[model samples]
Target chain A: SQTIHQWPATLVQPVGSPLSLECTVEGTSNPNLYWYRQAAGRGLQLLFYSVGIGQISSEVPQNLSASRPQDRQFILSSKKLLLSDSGFYLCAARGGPTGTYNEQFFGPGTRLTVL
Target chain B: AQSVTQLDSHVSVSEGTPVLLRCNYSSSYSPSLFWYVQHPNKGLQLLLKYTSAATLVKGINGFEAEFKKSETSFHLTKPSAHMSDAAEYFCVVSDLWGKLQFGAGTQVVVTP
Candidate 1:
């Protein structure tokens, strides 16, 4: 079975503060990773996705960026957080082409509150 | 471009009654569709997916959705509504490249 983990389940930061959220997948290799943000009462917004290490695609232009330094590790970072950056952040991993459906498995998510 | 539209933003249903969450989609090419559920404060969970293999797909928690090509709809249904089923449901469509386009989601409220 494969599982995904995210850290700093809940965070409180001030505007202009640095931010980092980590996500890692277990029992899978070279999976496609994605970062999503959901505003209160809004739909999930795709922020970034990575096909492989050092290959990142930004779906939306925002204050945040994503990086996949290792095959199973993905990181979401911000040099300076903005008040609009407060929301629920999610990390997801999808099986490679050889595996089953292209469905994504998500981590527990991190709730960020910018004051 | 691919897109999904969930018909309802909020639906309240009595327990044991049927549940329906309507969704419509548009895609440039043949599309793959999916329904995902998110409990409060939890990550999104894949309830089911339709990948051009089967039109009717059964998912976890006794939920199922049927894809209608002519209508361009993939509506989720459940025989009996449970209290645990109260959550947010998202309709998703993916183009051939596996990029997903998500709907604004519908909130299901189960009443006792």
Candidate 2:
């Protein structure tokens, strides 16, 4: 019965602007959090992942950064956004090991259009 | 390193017909494989997964995939396709640390 929620389902930002996307999971504790981005008609690219609060791993170097401020709250931020930063950003979560391999559950996603 | 390959970039099928989406993968160890579906501008949804327990795995929305070790293939299929099945499907492989590697994705187009 766990669910993931993302804010600002859609956003239009001008170039060189700041970016902030939030993700939170309810009904779960100490879950693994991930941030992924998908370009138009392309697959997902892992941007960052967190195992616990204040612990974040970057999968690829880019204009974005992630922070886990709470056990179930993750945020993706950028001081200045680039045109290339425009894409569909997704947040996913998986429960901690419970004697079985956990499958990731995804949030609705945030669509950012940079103009 | 673990990787996944979705054979077709796009597949077109008629309504009420069989649905087949091919996927192959490579992994250094016994890997966990998954199938996810993405509606337009939506997030990916887990369809099914293979964790070395069952060769054939059934997923939501009447979709199933069979894992072939020799071929390293996990192909998804459905007995009858519906218009609602038109979407993009991805083949995913999990690494040692449980991070997912996604395929380029296959866009399934259902024709009336």
Candidate 3:
């Protein structure tokens, strides 16, 4: 069975501080990775997605960026965080292009509170 | 472009009663649809999916949904509600490549 791990489960960061959230998947290879953010009581907003290592696509322009350093290792980072960046950040993965598999498995999200 | 609309922002139901949550969607092509559940502060868990093969899909936790093409609706239903079912549910539509578009979630409240 495949599983995803993310950390720190919760974080409190000061405004304008650097931020880093890491995600990794086990028991799968060459999986597509995605980053999403959900504001309080709001729907998920796609941040970034990667097809392979060193390949990333940004869905929304923001202070946050995502990088796939390895096939199953994805990282979300920001040089300087903004107050608007405070939200529940989620990492998701799906089996690579094998056909019409559209289901995405999500990781335990990181709750970032920028104060 | 694909989109999902959860008609009710919140739904309240009594325990052991039937539960229904409404969802509507718009897609340019034959799309894939899904319903996901999220416990408070937890990650989303996929409940069910429709990929044009079956109009009625059964999911985990005794939840089921019917895909109506003419009405453009996929409404989730449960025969008996449980207290544990109190959570937020999201209706999502996606393409074959996993580019998902989610609806503003509907919060389900189970009353004792």
Q: What is the DockQ of candidate 1?
A: 0.54
lDDT of 3: 0.94
DockQ order, best first, reads 3, 2, 1
Residues B8-82, candidate 2: write the lDDT tens digits: 999999999999999999999888899999999888899999988989999999999999999999999999999
- Which of the two candidates, 2 or 3, achieves a greater lDDT against the reference? 3
TM-score (chain B only), all candidates: 0.97, 0.98, 0.98
How accurately is candidate 3 docked according to DockQ? 0.72
Tens-digit lDDT string for candidate 1 (A1-115): 5699998999999999999999999978888888999999999999999889999999989899999999999999999999999999999988767334488888999999999
Q: Note the clash tally of each candidate.
A: 0, 0, 0
For model 3, residues A1-115, the per-residue Cα lDDT tens digits are: 5689999999999999999999999978999899999999899999999989999999999998889988999999999999999999999998858467568999989999999
- Residue B33 lDDT in model 1? 90
Error of 1 at B99 (Å): 2.0
Tens digits of per-residue lDDT, candidate 1, B1-112, equal 8889999999999999999999999987778899999999999999999988889999999999999999999999999999999999999986554567889999999999
Q: How well does model 1 score by local distance difference test?
A: 0.92
CAPRI accuracy category, model 3:
medium
Work out the iRMS of candidate 2: 2.3
iRMSD value for model 1 = 2.6
lDDT per residue as tens, model 3, B1-112: 8899999999999999999999999999877899999999999999999999889999999999999999999999999999999999999998877888999999999999
